[model samples]
Target: MREYEYHAPLSLERLFELAEAEGMEVRFLAGGTDLMPRISAERNQIPRDRKPPMRIIYLGGLGLDEVTDDGESVTIGATASLSALLDNGAVRTKLPALHEALREMAGVSVRNTATIGGNIMNASPAADSVPPLLVLGAECLLRSAAGERRVALSEFFTGPGKTVARPGELLVSVTVKPGRGGSAFRKLGRRKAETLSVVNAAACVELRDGLCESVRIAVGSAAPVVVRCTGAEQALVGKKIDENSVREAGALVVKALSPIDDIRSSAWYRARVAPTMVARALLAAAERKRG
Candidate 1:
């Protein structure tokens, strides 16, 4: 890899000061799961017309690695590793779908090194944790030298590998209010595990008096960004969830997807399986809720 200055800031204040410095190509380094690979590729051959970073501001020493609850919401700090998430009881109990996604994300080694912030900030449409988090109505907390701001997770991504966060802004944490019902995440990949998703779906439903009071359905890797199946969710509300309703709602999910033919799968395959995955996720979620 090309030699670059690495600064391990002692505090958030020091991190901000370094980020604000003018005319320097600065990339915030967290987890090193994604950044290391990219850096190695750049060293071998720089991307055409792309500017190389002058420095990497490592956040490991800054202590932004905690998972805590504030009664209503769970805040996952940017530096909190996936292994840390697997051990948090509150996260597992309150956000079962997210827990499931994390458990299946990758093997033990990758999970130990990959942070939640890196996963979100990578902004991949196929990110395993995103659809689950999206269905939970999560929000991202961003900080810069100036101040901090909160952006709904649904609004965070503009496109694949792109987000609304500015160059100087650092993603600090992700926040989500616990939902009342059980949820499920389903992913389709080239392999059974340790692979990128070709299509993935998640469902969250709150049942009251045997009727769906509230519902959220999100699909990923089938669109430019992870998307909520609002029409399908609307159809599920106030209705008893059954095989027929689920099948119909699943059709609506297929209608909502805009999958493209990629190396992982064909658009036809994704379009066909999207509804099936949605149905399966919903059914699994309902079963979990009843249990």
Candidate 2:
């Protein structure tokens, strides 16, 4: 990477001042999992006008690394590592879908270094944690020198490798409210571990008196950004989640996708496998012990 001045600001205020001074040219170093390699590879290739910053602000001392659950919602700080999330008892018990996603993410070493904020800010179409977050009705907390605002995880991403975070803003935390039912996450990759997903799915469903009370489903690598299968969710709501209903909902998920051919898999393959993945997620969610 280009030689850059490193600033380790001890407080959020100092970090914001640096950001304000540098404007769009300042880059935040969270876990450095995504930033380091990308900057190294693209340093000499990108055009000058579009080049990323050479000023780095390390977030190690900013006290943003935390995980807190108040029984209603779980708030994960920006610098909280994926491995840390996996170790939290509350995360495992209340957010099974998220737990599953974290477990299926890049192996132990990578998880130990990758931060949740980095994963969200990277805005990858196949980001492992995002689908489960979406199903749990997660919201992102963004802060700047000016103030703070909350954006739903569904609305945080604008496109692949893009987000709505402003020039001076930083992602502070992600808050996920507990869903009213069982949840599950499933992903298909070239291998069992340490591989990017070809297709990933998450589902949360509430059953009442043998019928679906509410449901939320999300799929990744099927669109430009992780997307909620609202059509399928609507179809399943209030309906008995039987074999036919599950199959029909899965078909609806496929219909909602906008897949494209890429190095990992063909558009046809993604489209074909999407329904089964959705069905599997639903079945897994349905099987989760009802609270």
Candidate 3:
């Protein structure tokens, strides 16, 4: 990596001051799992149009690594490691879809070093955490020198690797409201472990008197951003969780998808399998509710 100045600010005030400093290109360092790799690749560039030197502000000292459950919702601090969330009772018991996604993400070692905020900020369409978080109604808390604001996770991503967060703003935490229903997550990849998703799906369903009371479905790697399948969700509500209803809901999900051909899979293949994945997620969630 190129030479750069590093700052470890003990307070958010110091961090914001460093971020807002005039004329310096600044980046926040959380887990560094993603940032470090990108930084190391800069050395291989031709150097004719190299980017400016980066000023990294380490976020570890700012005490933004806590995970707390306040009965109504669970708030995960931006710097909280993925492994930390997996061990939290609220995450495991109250948010099963997110819990399952975290379990299947990368591997144990990488999870230990990857932060929840980093995963959200990276904003990959195939990111495993996003689909489940979207279905669970997660929100992000962004902070700056001016103040703080909350953005719904569904509305946060504008495109791949992009978000609406203003300049000089830091992602402070992600808060998710737990649902009374059951939820599930499913992923398809080249291999079972340590692989990026080709397509992933998540669903949360509430059942009442053998009928679907409500449902939320989200699919990743099927569009530019992880998206909720509201069409499918609407179709499933008030219907019995049976073969025909599940199949119809699955088919409706394709209307919301606009997948592209990529290194891992083809657009046709994703479209073909996406419906099955969505159906499976819904089936699993419904079974969980019944159990």
- Which structure among the candidates has the greatest lDDT? 3
What's the CA RMSD for each of the models? 1.6, 1.9, 1.3
What's model 2's overall lDDT? 0.89
TM-score of 1: 0.95
TM-score for each model? 0.95, 0.94, 0.97
Clashing pairs in 1: none
For each of the candidates, give the backbone clash count: 0, 0, 0
- How would you encode candidate 1's per-residue C-alpha lDDT over 1-25 as one tens digit per residue? 3447789999888888888756668
Q: List the residue pairs that clash in candidate 3.
A: none
Which digits, one per residue and each the tens of the lDDT, describe model 2 over residues 162-233?
999998799999999985788999999989889999999999998999789999999999899999999999
Question: Which digits, one per residue and each the tens of the lDDT, describe model 3 over residues 67-91?
Answer: 8998999999999998999998989
Residue 3 in candidate 2 has what lDDT?
A: 54
Q: How does residue 52 of candidate 2 score in lDDT?
A: 48
Give the Cα lDDT of each candidate: 0.89, 0.89, 0.91
State in Å the error of residue 43, model 1: 1.2
Winner on TM-score between 1 and 3 is 3
